[model samples]
Target: MPHTLIRIDDLEDPRIAAYRDIRERDLVGRKGRFVAEGKVVLNVLFSTARFAAESVLLRENRVPGMTHIIDRIPPEVPVYVASGDLMDAIAGFPMHRGVLAIGLRSEEEPAEALLARLPSEALVVALAGISDHDNMGAIFRNAAAFGADAVIMDRTCCDPLYRKAIRVSVGAALKVPFARGGSADAVADTLEAQGFQVLALSPSGKQAIEDVERAPRCALLLGAEGPGLPEALLSRLPSVRIPMRADFDSLNVATAAAIALHRLWRPPTL
Candidate 1:
């Protein structure tokens, strides 16, 4: 079965309503749907079994260039094409990438369920109060680059599925498995219950990141910038800090995560 390229001529066409005013829709939420922009992200959307592509919207000129990617779409999903002008109109902005897709997130997996599914030997990135989208995306990208088993986010963290975050991650957000709801302490407790050695990342951490030994199952816990992990939480966990200049005591949460993940990551054994 082949994917059908549906021509979208009417600006008000209901079929593409999901792609309308994308930036605004991003804020209000998409009702379980997320927009994947650009060729790279769309590739993940079509290739991954974790999410379903409800439909795709491409600038008319982009169709020829995107045939390779479009061919991978499931036969049942519609691929929409429109002129660049109409594409901009539909999106409520200039869409330079000319590639757009709406993907459906199935009911989100709970943090406990996600943790239970990981292999006995795993490395996880646990985040707290990280509400910035770019940082959220970057952390996920780092998680993917470093081969972390999964990411668990406290309730205060921003949505990794947000369009801009997904874009910043260069599609890593789609590839990384993550669970999004729980308090900082609750998330840590959940990771600990799963036999994970949870290490908090803080500037004042007693141990240097390089000095800490990786456990069979380890989790690097990070908190938001400025006001890092809570004092009480920091006091409870064995913590590690990245060595830095004397005056500088902090790194962006994502930067800290990348550094910690790189140091802690081990390649999977065959």
Candidate 2:
């Protein structure tokens, strides 16, 4: 079946509301939906079963190159096309990428439910107070790359589904399975209850990450950039640090997560 393409000459058209004022709208909130930008992110949205697309909006010139992706989308989903100037006006910015999508994630499940479903041997990432979207996205990308089973985010963490995060992750945000909510200790308690060796990543950690032994299931807990993990939380869990220069205390949260995940990651054997 051929995909329907609608030309957008009217800025007031309700169907393309998802694409309007994209910069502000992305931060404002999408209720349950998220906007996916660029060809790479759009391809992940179309290919992944984790989310469903409400519609696709793109510059007219992008349509011809996107036929392969268009055919894969359900016939009922509308594809809106607009001229470059119109797209820029609608998006409230210079729309260089020329592609956008509206997608909805299913209702979020509790962290406990996500922990309960983990396999016997798995790698999980638990985040606390990570309010930066770019860091959150980079961590998710690292999680996916290192074969983590799931990601658990605490209440204070920023949304991984945020547009910049999604774009920065290069769509890995959509690919990874994650659950967010609950207090920092509550999240840690849940992981501990699930038999995960909850290891907090901290600069003051007594153990070096390279020397720490891998457990059947492990959760790497990380906090925000400046403060690192809170002392209250750090005291409760076994902590591990990436060995660094005497003068350097820490790496960025995302870079640290990538390094730790690589050390703890257990890739499945076929």
Candidate 3:
């Protein structure tokens, strides 16, 4: 397959506008687009059905090793190559990986639609008010690792498609099926309506996680680290706590989620 590698000699070229000032754009802009950095993430971006690349920016020297990957990109997509210094100038910092792709967000099914589509026996991770991008990304990574059917996030949660979150998840943010933007209660209600037994994780709960038997379909609800789940919500659901020493009250939201997900996980058989 023929590859079109457009050398980026001028930093001011409008074609590479999306790659400029990458950090600032990641913070307040990007519209419905995202950055896929490093070779690993770029590979996932190309393969993921949920996303499509508008263009790719790569260090000219790094193209040799990425030939096969570049060849796989749809011909309609432009491939831009720049010198290391030029790449650094455009990004406003050293992006050592030298491989970056700008991808547009693909539409996702609604939470209710996604829930109704789940297999009869499914495990889901629900996040409420998880404002930290790192934690959100880690949760998504853990969800993918544990074979979670889907991850549902409330409106207050950070965008998992943010560059840092996607990088931290190592592209799991793209691989894992997810739905965002709803009130916490609304999310829980949707899960319950789909015949999912929702379990809320709290440090003070009477039941140990191990003691709770797995349901045919389960949705584990987690919240931001310090505030944890709201008391009103906690009171309504069966709460389970992880056993820990008295000195520490809780684990980071992401770590706690991993533990709970692993315990509840039932891997699919061939």
Best by TM-score: 1
Model 3 pairs in collision: none
lDDT of 2 by residue, 195-254 (tens): 999999998897999999979999999999898888998998899999999986768899
lDDT winner between candidates 1 and 2: 1
Output the lDDT of residue 72, model 3.
83
Error of 2 at 205 (Å): 1.2
Ranking by lDDT: 1, 3, 2
Clash totals, every prediction: 0, 0, 0
TM-score of candidate 1 versus the correct structure, residues matched by position: 0.97
- Model 1: per-residue Cα lDDT over 163-212, one tens digit each: 99999888888988999757899999999999999999998999999999
Query: Each candidate's TM vs. the true structure?
Result: 0.97, 0.96, 0.96
Off by over 4 Å in 3: none
**Tens digits of lDDT, candidate 3, 1-270:** 788799889999999999999999988978889998988888888887778899999998899999878978999999999999999999999989999999998786799999899999999999999998899889988988898989999989999999989988888898888997489998999999999999999998768998889798999999899898988889998888999999967689989999999999987778
- For model 2 the local lDDT of residue 62 reads 88
**Which ten-residue region of model 1 has the weakest summed lDDT?**
246-255
In model 3, the worst 10-residue window by lDDT is 41-50
The segments of candidate 2 whose C-alpha lies over 4 angstroms from its true place after superposition are none
